[model samples]
Target: MNAEQALIAYVLRLADNALILGQRMIEVVAAGPELEEELANANFALDFIGQARMLYTCAGELEGQGRSEDDFAFMRDEREFQNLLLLEQPNGHFGDALVRQFLFESFYVHLLDGLTRCSAPGLAEIAARAIKEVKYHLRHHSQWLIRLGDGTELSHARVQASLDDAWQYTGEMFVADAVDTVVHESFAGPDLEAVAVLWRRDVAAVVEQATLALPGDQAMASGGKDGRHSEHFGFLLAEMQTMQRSFPGATW
Candidate 1:
């Protein structure tokens, strides 16, 4: 695809990741381990959803379409979403959720920092605004990762298992395709190869502090960038889009 199309697709990929993860977090709104943690979970969910709104709005502008962010979010089919397979994974437990957040945010923080300098004016502006929130997200998740991993033997074991399960999904984050190459090469987008280097360093530091071992490189699960997703995505989309599908254009 051309540069413009590639950029549009790139923005949607960002939006989908934030949106899906936000939905996953919101699933634990009233089920957090504690009251304060529940509040934090809700707040983090809003942060991601807010990010998604901005991204979807920008994608709509880039597409030169009349579609609103709601339409892009609520009216899309499961296969149409470009979110990473990692984000769509089920939130199994408290530790599972934290591990997922830490891994994704570690990479996301670097990705946004690079986007802030991209040639696209809109993307740079959005990245500039979003990176501040992402910094906190990384810190929050990273701290929890260290806590759970270094805490009790039980906590350590569970979190470590969660990390291992999530490790395979992490590979897709740095696998650049035509969409990534066109955007980075022509549109001054983030070099994902470089992002991968930073990701490894950041993740390794946390793993070391937590007394956890990094999993070996294994066969990577991919295809979310190309609108392919795991089995969980359909269930997520069904719940997320039910209202819009049931009542087309119905609004408060």
Candidate 2:
């Protein structure tokens, strides 16, 4: 793809990641262990959804399409989405959700920081705004990882297992592709190699502090960014788009 096409795809990838994870979080808003936690989870979900809106809007503009954010979000088929496989995983449990967020945010925080200085002025501005919210997100999830990891024996074991299961999906975050290459070369966008280094160090430190065993490198799962998604994605997209599909052009 050319540089402009790659730039639009890159932004859409970011939006897809945020929107998918945010929708997953919405699934368990009422399932939080504590009321305070539930409220926090809801707010965090909104933060992600809010980020997705901005990104989708930016991408729509960049594409010079008449499509709105709702069009990009609600009109897309399952194969059209380009989120990471990690974000589409079921919210199996509280611990599962927590590990997923912690893992993704760890990498996302670094990514947005790089984008804040990218050559694309519009994306740089979005990244600057996003990184601020993501900083707090990282800290919140990091603290939860420590709490659950160093807590009771059962809690520790469960969350650790969650972390291990999620690790394989994490590999996709740093798998730089042609889209990444184009954006980076043209816009000084994020270098996934550099992002990977920071990701490992930060994640390792958190694991150590949580008294959890760092998972071994294992076979990685990818392809979500290229429109190949996990089995759960179709179901997720259907549910999320139900209202829009059932009632076209409906709005709040």
Candidate 3:
């Protein structure tokens, strides 16, 4: 792919991850254990949706097509989405969701940091704007991870199990594919190897502080970048695209 294509792909990958995870969080909107956390979850969901819009707009422009952000978002099949597998994993319980976001936001903060220096000016600008929002997102999730991990024994055990169950998916985030390679080599994007090292350190520190055990590194699942998504993605898309799919042109 050319530089622009590579850059758009990279941006959309970030956006897709955010969007899918945000949608998952939204599923628990009214179910948060506390009122303050409910508001925080809603705010974070909107932040990811906003980022998704920005990325989709950029991708549409780069594609030079009549396609709009809505088209790219609601119309795509699960197999066409490039989100990380971790993001698409089901939100099992409160603890499950919290640990998942904690794991992702920790890595995403650094990813956005690297993106701020992208060779493409537009992509860099997008990343610069996004990094601010993601910083807060990382903080929010980190705080929850600590609270739940260090809370009552029941809470700690549940969160620990959540972390363990979700751990395998974490590896996919660092596995650089062809598109990522092109972006890094040609466009000064994130160095996946370096990001992985830093991610491990940051994650380990947080887990240690939370009094949670770090999960062992093992075989990682892949295929999101190559358009293969988990079965859960289809259900997510079905819910997410219901209105657009059923009505075709309905709007507020």
Candidate 4:
């Protein structure tokens, strides 16, 4: 693909990841175990949704399409989304959701930090703005990770299992596929391999502090970046797109 096409694809991938994950988090908005945490989760969900809007708007402009951010967000089918499997994973329990966000936000903060230096001016600007939001997201989730990991034995075990079950999906985040190659080589995007090293160190430190064991590398799951998603994505899209799909351009 040419530079512009490559750039749009890259941006959409970032947007899709955030949007899909945000939608998943919204699923548990009223279901959080604690009142404070419920507010925190809602806050984080909105943050991701805002980031997605910015990225999607940029992507739409890059594509020179009439489509708006809402069009892309609320009109797409499950197969069209290019988010990682981890983001779409079910919120099994409070700890499960927390671990999922912890894993993603930790990696995402580092990635956004690197994106702030990208060769593309627009992308760099978006990254600069996004990094601020993601910083707090990391902080929120990290606190929870420590809380659950260092809490009662039952909480610790449940959260640990959440980490273990979700561990395989983490590999795909740093795998550097075609879009990654194009963006890194041409647009000076974040280096996934380098980010992976730092991600591991940061994640390991948090896991240790949480009194949780690190998951062993057995096999890694992949393919969310290539428009492949979990079965759960359909349900997410069904709920997210219901209003838009039913009304077709109707807005408040």
Candidate 5:
């Protein structure tokens, strides 16, 4: 596509990742294992949602089609979403959620850091503001991952399994496609290959600290960047979009 279209797509991809993960975390809002963690979970959920809002607003402006953030978020079909497959995967348990967040946040933080210096001023500004929050997010998840993976026998096994299951989905994060190439070449956006290297180092360090084994190399599942997703994505969209679909234009 053209430069503007590529930019819009790039922003939507980022927005979709945040929105989906934010929705997933909200599922555990009051169900966190403890009171302190419950509040922390809610706050983190809001952080992702807030980031989604900023990206969607930027995308809407770039598209200049009169679409709002709500429209992009609530009005889109399941197949139209461009979030990572890993983000849409079910948050099975406490460990499952933490592992998922840790993996994605590891990559996201670097992506935002690179975007902060991109040629696109609007995207660079958003990235600059977002990197701060993402840094905290990465820290939070990384610490929890270490705790769980190095905890009791059961905790260790569970988190290790979560990591392995989640590993397959991680491949998509770095597999740059045409959209990514255009965005990088035109807007000076993140180099996915470079980001992948940093992501792996961070992940390996945490896994080692947690006393967990690094997941073995295997066939990587992908296609999320192209609007293709895992089966779980449909259910996520059903719940996420129900209100707006039922109410049409109704608002608070």
Candidate 6:
């Protein structure tokens, strides 16, 4: 793919990740054990959805197509999406969901921090705005993990298991592909290798503070950024696209 195509793909990948994760998070809207957490979770979902909208719009502009954010979101088939496999995994339990967010946010904060420095048109601005909110998201999730980790023995074990279950998927976040290569070379975009280093250090520190052990390196699952996703992704796509597909042009 040319540089332009690579950039569009990269932006869409970002949008897809945010949109899918936001959908996953909203599933627990009324299910959070605490009312405060429920509200915060809902707000966090909105933050991600809002970021997805902005990034989609930017991608649409870059593509010079008539497509809008909704078109990119609700009109896409399962194979068209490029979200991370980690984001598509089921929310098994409260600790499962919490650990998932903590892990992703740890990497996302660093990713966005690097994106904020990208010279690509529209990317740096969006990344700059997003990093501000993501910093808070990272902080919130990190504190919660520490609390749950250092809590009761049961809490510690479950979240530790959650950490291990989610660790395999973590490798994909830094597995820079062709799009990553083009963006970095042409636009001074994120260096995933560098981000990986920062992510490892931050994650190790948080894991230590939580009195948790980090999972050892293992075979990493990938391909989501290439439009290949887990089995759960089809169901997610079906639910997210139902309204738009059912009512073509319906809008507020």
What are the clashing pairs of model 1? none
- Residue pairs that clash (backbone atoms under 3 angstroms), model 3: none
Q: TM-score for every candidate vs. truth?
A: 0.98, 0.98, 0.96, 0.97, 0.98, 0.98
lDDT of each: 0.93, 0.94, 0.87, 0.89, 0.92, 0.92
Which residue segments of model 1 deviate by more than 4 Å? none
Candidate 5 off by > 4 Å = none
> Worst ten-residue run, lDDT, model 5?
120-129
Better of 1 and 2 by lDDT: 2
Model 4 segments beyond 4 Å from truth?
none
Decide which is better by TM-score, 3 or 5: 5
Clashes of 2: 0
How much is the lDDT of residue 121 in candidate 5?
A: 48
lDDT of 4 by residue, 116-143 (tens): 9999758889889989988988888898
lDDT of 6 at 103: 84
lDDT by residue for model 6 over 1-252, one digit each (tens)?
A: 999999999999999999999999987789988899899999999999999999999999999979999999999888899999999998899889888888888889888988988888999999999988888988998998999999999999999999999998998999999999999999888899999999999999998999999999799999898889999989988888899899987998
Question: Total backbone clashes of model 4?
Answer: 0
TM-score of 5: 0.98
Candidate 1 per-residue lDDT, tens place, 157-240, comes to 999999999999999999999999999998889999999999999999999999999999799999888888888888999999
| RMSD of each candidate relative to the true structure | 0.7, 0.8, 1.2, 1.0, 0.8, 0.7
The TM-score measured for candidate 3 stands at 0.96
